[model samples]
Target: MNLRKEILVTGAAGFVGRETVKQLLAEGWKVRALVRTADTNPLAFHAGLSVQEVGDIAAVADWSSLVSGCDVVVHLAARAHKTGEGPNAARELFRRVNVDATVELAKAAAAARVKRLVFVSSAGVMGDFSARPFTEADPPQPASEYAISKWQAEQALREICRQSNMELVVLRPVLVYGPGNPGNLERLMRLVASGLPLPLASVDNRRSLLNVRHLATIIGRALELAEANGKTVLLADGNDLSTPELVRTFAKGMGIKARLFPIPPLLLLAAARLLGRSHDAERLLGSLQVDVTLKTNLFGALPREETLRGLIETGQAGR
Candidate 1:
């Protein structure tokens, strides 16, 4: 696990992939970014990185050449959205990208004698957040197409590693947020910034979040430590924040008072169902938390507990 060795990063154009690549480059690692097209450049900001155009991982073309000189493979490419497409379409796309492509990549990595394969998995595979505080040991009860695909990918990767004798490390991170976040967190921030009254004050649910910097640091440490081999780690900032508190914190950080109305949870759920936005209700009202003690103890490093403060600071800086 020498920092000077080469590593192949799939989905290098993605949010987490971009940050991870930056960290790896900063550590003096040679990065070979696998992209779909030669023109699909990420925010590398002119950092000196080797780029390879391997179109559509599902096609299963020669990936051995891609990882020929790499010591590690970090798989970050997957279908990550939840809406717009139907469930069947989503499942099929995810299976192709997450499951089939991942297996093929691992096989190629093993063929290339790569030392480690790190898979970025989603915590949603643990199931909906109805229950607070889920751990890595919890039986996977994936409730959505996205979650199911991630779980299947993990299984496929493990089986491939078992047959090929390659080291596998799976990391499940919850709601990774940072300055350029583009998911639900960004949507909420936009709404809060508009000074509109949000009906999330009554939702008393706690959820775990990971800052991108912390996540990148954990990935780097996992690569360096051999003890992380054949292990699954759930990553979080070791702090849980309620929906109201999160919104209020963001609002206050933006120099505005939070305009929140405490609506009944049941009524909100019904409204969400009628509007075909049940995911929104589930996220705001559901209680899903994680314990990062195992990750901290294993790596001898802990994520900062000042998640809200960090978010505020980073978000404002970005603004």
Candidate 2:
């Protein structure tokens, strides 16, 4: 029943990757971390980790050598943000890193005889902004290039696993937030700290979120559970927070009062389009909540209130 064996973790320097490695080590697994750069001292504090410098996930030579003898491979690296690029360019970049490189690594891991491959995919692959909560059974209707790339990567891994007889477990996690989170969550916190009366209060859309610790724990369980093989799981905190509630909670967590303004969502969207920032508006005002019934049924229901409290406490301490 012990799944703790030699494991290779791609993107070991990243946020999720680092957390995964730490948790895996705590579970008494021999972890071999693949890093793009030689300067891995930041992650050198952990014991029983064999660090290897591999240039790019796609062009890395001898991937079989890196993963050979490993029992599992956890792929976590990808092109996350679009930045200031056109849709085509963004799609190409995502394809190169998220799709093509991911498939190559999965293939290499299977070739190396790795027992299981855990892919960290995004929940965004479910579809566009909608009022309905997405479940694993929902047909994928990817809206953006990033989502498409993730979908393609999932298919590639599934196909490779089918042919190579490798156990594949895919995880679709919602907006993962925690300490040291350097994404839109951080930006929102900063905005709240600025004491600006935001118009987002009127938008009543629920969103699912995952704390980093909970995500790592679920991943650990997935690695151990035999039934998780060839299964895709959606991971979330099981509590859907509205836009206003999230802002208020974040403010409360930081010991600050939120200056909220109730503004029409349609007007905000129009303004964002006029300002050439429709993407920002869509991400903030959009509705993309998910149903965690499958995850709860498989991993047991996570303590939602406790997890949210931990997130707030961690955020406050970090600030």
Candidate 3:
């Protein structure tokens, strides 16, 4: 059924984008994968894959040519937070790429009469941590510049699609672990690999993680499922683990002993705050979860082993 449907995927060379393109092709879908000039094609040549080089997404003057024959547009390209960048600068750049460019693409897709636009958004829009599981109905409190841009993009897309014939599906996924995971998760995995004794044993924070591959599978579901249209869903692997447990799992995946010692959680948080890394500390020493408490479970829960495999796979991939 999907063989005849060509999905246009932006950022097709990114970590998640690469996996998603593969997943869609594996599911017998045709893919028009977009790659940046500097980024290598994510996958080996396949008959179902068509790679399009779009140098810089924000600078793309015309999106109509890209969306002309596509059934769905899986938007993933966005400016990520760079190290040492100021908040104001980050906000402006993120708005340009994440918000402005996303709205433009959505508008183009609508004009092209594309059936759906599946946007991969961040769960961080709810903030770095949630006291309980979050739901779609929760009012977003985007904490960082990057998150705020994503929230704004979501709103813009919602408003645009509301008046257009095209459908919209927003997926807000939590920390994803996989080959080439580029943020704190990758840092922590490397930290565990370094065998540094982490003083996080006492930090009993519950964090929900998703696999990049699982996220790709979810993207496919969002593409085909009629119920997913017009819905912004929270995504996670459903295996919430504490800081110690998480570190231990990382160690287990990497085949090492987790050298961890106990420390007062408040002391850790306070020290992190003094260092202006409170948000990063909170992710490790706080509880951030998502559930179907509101009865909006669009997908079934994956198990602890899948997360373990995701970590192990991350280890093997040298990410």
lDDT for every model?
A: 0.82, 0.82, 0.85
Which portions of model 2 show Cα errors greater than 4 Å? 1-4, 82-88
User: Superposing every Cα of model 1 onto the true structure, what RMSD results?
Assistant: 2.1
Candidate that would win on lDDT: 3
Q: Assess candidate 1 and give its lDDT.
A: 0.82
> Model 2 shows how many backbone clashes?
0
Q: Kindly report which residue stretches of model 1 are placed more than 4 angstroms away from their true locations once superposed.
A: 1-4, 45-48, 82-89, 300-305, 317-319
Residues 266-297, candidate 1: write the lDDT tens digits: 99999999999877777878888887778877
Q: Write the candidate numbers in order of decreasing TM-score.
A: 3, 2, 1
**How do the predictions measure up, each by TM-score?**
0.92, 0.94, 0.94
Model 3 over residues 202-275: C-alpha lDDT tens digits?
Answer: 88778888889888988988897888888888888877788798788778767789999998999998999999
| lDDT of each residue in 1-319, candidate 2, tens digit only | 2344788888888878878888888888888888878675357565678888887776775677887889888888787874465444656778988988887788888888888999999898997676688989989888778888999999988999999978999999998887777667777778887888998879988888888878888887887688888889888899878878888888778888778888899999999999998877887888888888888877777777866785686458545
